[model samples]
Target: MTAADTFETILEMRARAVEDLLGSLLDERILPGEIARPARLLQAMRHGVLNGGKRLRPFLVVESAGLFGADQDAALRVAAALECVHCYSLIHDDLPAMDDDDLRRGQPTVHKAYDEATAILAGDSLLTLAFDILADEATAIAADRRAALVLALARAAGAGGMAGGQALDLDAERTQPDEAGIITLQAMKTGALIRFACEAGAIVAGAPAADRERLAEFGSAIGLAFQLADDLLDLTSDTTTLGKTAGKDVAAGKATLVQLHGPDWTRRQLDGLVLQARELLKPYGAAASTLKLAANFVATRRK
Candidate 1:
């Protein structure tokens, strides 16, 4: 296949892999009489986790694993855990007290479809379930590696990373931070999980220290690129295409790359980041194509 065709094929395969992993989680039976009215919470959790999303985080995890010649099935379990954490974050982020968004992935936000309390519980459940799944029998990796994976994920999702970044973002909102502050906030809030996705894959694959570091760099660069693209899209794209509330960022008086450096400069920064990410993956040779394509897609995506 040509490069474009190869990318499309890989994307399709990765999407299917993510769907199957998510489906397994959603389709599994919840023990009866575990908790009072558990079904409601279960349904809410499934709604948020199973909702249509780009599944980019999981895809990155799987692709990174592939670079190390790891089993796809094992990699997928890690990916699923990552997605669970991500979906939970989104669910909470859209709550009335948070971003107060009413839409997500082209559908009603969790709080809009269900009550805010239910949404909060759902997000909490998903977050706990992510660790549960990672520790479950499905993970076939070595015990040491699995432990490392769990630690990596926790650090990325916990107070020092994504959560900390979000807290910073909320604080920044009150004061309307400058450009550097915005980038730093996004690097943590958004970039942490993306970096974890790549790192988790490498851990599962038992990649060497050097390769792991390279993948981490690749992940960090692409994570920044992804955030930049989102900022740009928030400016240039409409709500219909973005599947979420558009112009909300600007309306919220949040500082973004567009607000700081303007759209053209932001786009240029995105290109530079994509280039940096691609260079980090160069050692992987032919196996790096998917990573390169993903970086390009993140930088150039309209929505």
Candidate 2:
């Protein structure tokens, strides 16, 4: 297979693995003294999370953890927890007050599949479940490490991170932001979780501060690369290929690097980002070959 195809295969395998792990958890999600989970809430949660998503954040968690000899099961659980947060965000992001997206992962969005209220609750449930998974001793992480993971996830997903970025995005629709503003917005909105994905591994494995900083830089560079690639795709690709509504950014007058600087400039930026990410991995060498390839994939992915 080509490099893109190889990377795609690896991503698919990881996505499937996470999906299976999530399915197992959902099956046994019931806790003591509970008759059964409310069917609709559970169903909505499953609907929002399963049968869709690349599980990219989780993949980073697993790969980064691998670099430091972290336990496989612990890495997988952390990955799963990250996925839950990601899926929850997607569900909320599709709400009418948010993006009002109807399609996601080639299917109706959660609010469309179920009612808006149910979708909201489902998202809330998934978000909380992410923390629960992290806090549980079953994840095999030490208590202190678990607390650190929870703090990191909260910060990444909360006001100072993704939510803050999104607030900026919403306002940007009314008043456009400059290129720098766009960078900050996209970094927080999209990059926070990705950075967490990389950094979480070092935390789980108890890697040194320097290694964590390097991985964070790597993730931030690639995260920017991924967004630039996505912006290019939004400008050039069709909805079918995107698995969601395409061309909405332009329609919404969304402030994007592509809008500030045309596709040509954005492509150049993506190239630089991929190079930077690869350079960051040089210290780890072949251990990061797969991740290096993933960086390239983010830059070139059609979807």
Q: Which candidate's lDDT is highest?
A: 2
User: Number of clashing residue pairs in every model?
Assistant: 0, 0
Tens digits of per-residue lDDT for model 1, 1-303: 777577767777787778777777766465343344377788888889887667889989999999999988889989999999999999999998988888776688888898999999999988987887787666888888878888889999999899989999898778787767787789889999999888877898999988888888889999999888888888889988986667878887788878788899988898899889998888889887888999998888877
The residue-by-residue lDDT of candidate 2 on 1-303, one tens digit each, is 887788888889988889999987777468764578888889889999996577888899998998888998999999999999989988999999998888786688889999999999999999998998899898997898899999999999999999898899889978788988999999999999999999999889888999989998998998899888988899988988887678989998887888778998988898899999999989888888888988888788888
Q: How close is candidate 2 to the true structure, as a TM-score?
A: 0.96
Lowest lDDT block of 10, candidate 2: 25-34
As for model 1, its CA RMSD to the true structure in angstroms is 2.2
What value does the lDDT take at residue 44 in candidate 1? Answer: 89
Off by over 4 Å in 1: 1-6, 28-37
**After superposing candidate 2, which stretches have Cα over 4 Å from the reference?**
32-36
Clashing pairs in 2: none
Whole-model Cα lDDT of every candidate shown, in order: 0.86, 0.89
Best by TM-score: 2
